[model samples]
Target: MSKPIRNSTEMTDITRLEQANAMMRLVNQALARNDLAALAALGFCHPHIGELKQQGGFRSSSIAQNTRMITRLRKVGDTHAQ
Candidate 1:
């Protein structure tokens, strides 16, 4: 059997990451594209991010990665467009 989580923060992190990974898979399928930037630009992202925030979590720890994720998800057809 798995050991119990050490504390709340640890539990939250575990739960959040697990959720993020699962969500990412579904998001990938929904997007029907592997382009990371594309996924970051739509309403789908809000639901994903909002759910994580509600869980008291972040998209990821790396600021660069978060920016990239957001940039990719933008609604513009051109992934690189500002």
Candidate 2:
């Protein structure tokens, strides 16, 4: 059997996953609000978003993961896009 992930690595992965999920939600909300400027501004600075915007195609799961991060950030008022 494969070795299990250490506790620290697992926690880090969970944190990153949560952040990605929140970002996705924020992107969706911004789109719904017709705030492309805000979306562009936000995505411009994000590593995954920037890469995706440049490439023009990304996996659904990757998009979903980032959306979740945006959503959570919005909920917590961490970004102005909301």
Candidate 3:
């Protein structure tokens, strides 16, 4: 059997997955409403949004990239909270 992930790593992975899932839901809502402004705020370019529209969903790469942004922004907030 494969080795299990350590607790810290598993928690990080779970957090990232949750962030990605949340981002996916927001993107879908924005897409359904044709909310370009909201999508743009999430770092999606016009061309990229067009492609996402055609695909009917954002790619994993896009989700991960945006999720990383969220993580970075959270870190900044945490630093301020200290």
Candidate 4:
């Protein structure tokens, strides 16, 4: 009953976290590849990156995380390089 409901809620949170991580990975890969089209499709652009860079707190954490992710992706080699 209540135990099962709690488990269900926890599972939902895990799923949401996984989804967010996947989205971040995709965004990082796109940036590494310099895939403007993919970035545009994901609603990311120079201004968005700039905003993230300028913000502090959670926003800053998010930006730092994303920047690291992109750097890692770039190091792995660009799959979409022109």
TM-score per candidate, chains pooled:
0.35, 0.46, 0.62, 0.49
Q: Per-residue lDDT tens digits of candidate 2, residues 1-82?
A: 5444335544565577776666666766665565657777775445654554555434567866565665564444423222
Per-residue lDDT tens digits for candidate 4, residues 1-82, read 2222224444455555556667776766665666667767877777875553344213336645655665555433333232
Ranking 2 against 4 by lDDT, winner: 2
Q: Please, what is the whole-model Cα lDDT of each candidate in the order they appear?
A: 0.47, 0.57, 0.76, 0.55
Best by lDDT: 3
Best by TM-score: 3
For model 1, what is the error of residue 78's alpha carbon versus the real structure, in angstroms, after optimal superposition? 46
Q: Runs in model 2 with CA error above 4 Å?
A: 1-6, 44-82
Worst 10 residues of 2 by lDDT: 73-82
Worst 10 residues of 1 by lDDT: 73-82
What TM-score number comes out for model 1?
0.35
Clashing pairs in 1: 37-72, 40-73, 41-73, 41-74
Q: Tell how far residue 19 is off in model 1, in angstroms.
A: 0.7
Every model: Cα RMSD to truth: 17.0, 13.1, 11.4, 14.3
**lDDT of model 3, residue 10:** 42
Q: Candidate 3's residue-wise lDDT over 1-82, tens digit each?
A: 5444334544566577677778898998899899999999999999999998999876667767766765675565555545
